[model samples]
Target: MRVVAVLAVVVLAAGCSASEPPPEDPSVDFSADDRKVTAEPFLYCDVQVKDCKRDNTAQVKLEVAPGTPVLVSVPQEVAETPWSVVIQYRTAAGEQMPPETVATFPPNKSSTFEALPPGDGDQLQTVEVKQAGAKLVRDDKGEAAAVSRGVWSAQISPPAA
Candidate 1:
């Protein structure tokens, strides 16, 4: 009887162990050269310029991996402003990539912009802003440009499956 009981206990333990899921692999498949740029969450500031007649200007920095498609979020209030907002990517060497106009939004609003890789073999990306017919206005002693007053976020990731 004792032998049978021991055998049952061993069988139960083995069954439980077999039913457990396999351990997950911690290794990520992305190459070491791949990089991503994201903006920290912060309060958006409303930018108003007198000469340009533009308002609600926000600046965001994005980092993109080579050959990867990145999505950028632009301030929403661009449409209501007098000037158009241009988005450009600046390389690490301080050279500006070709500018692409994503969208135009009304005042006190938000919008998302998508940026894709050039399909060439270049790396190291950053974002640039050019306000048409408006000069960049600096807020009270702040080095960064003023964005709309709202919760603004930006991110870079792989394309959807």
Candidate 2:
């Protein structure tokens, strides 16, 4: 009988804890060259309710070899919202390469992306993930624009010569 009571208490405690929400906000992860880093959103907002906050203090940086691919992973909170991966590269000769949006993923479509460095010995300098908010507005040209809801960015430093 005592064992049964103890088991019930343990089960009850586990259930209660499982029902509680996470203590911290979801984070984005970047992995490359056998190293991994995580970053909280420097800016985040709920577009439907127009609630937003910005933190200039948060940043994540990692060092990787040139021409290596970086893997970007997002939590469900980010994956459920439309998001895109933007990349910036630097040539081997230290010339800045034009930024490119590698791909835009629809809501709940993807949670992981492999960001490939462009050929020609270019190195990835930055990988940014932008989450589309719920609000939409028309631009000057009358085209609809989806406002940015959350941003998580990582800067990648190349190995020293």
Pick the TM-score winner: 2
Cα lDDT, model 2, residue 46 = 74
Candidate 1: residue pairs that collide: 37-63, 44-148, 45-147, 45-148, 76-109, 76-110, 79-105
TM-score of 1: 0.31
C-alpha lDDT (0 to 100) for residue 71 of candidate 1: 47
Per-model CA lDDT versus the true structure:
0.39, 0.87
Per-residue lDDT of model 1, residues 1-161, tens digit only:
99999999999999888865743211111111344343322332334423222222232334445555444433334324432233344454546577554444444454344444454543424332222223344768866443332332232222334
Worst 10 residues of 1 by lDDT: 24-33
Per model, how many backbone clashes are there? 7, 0
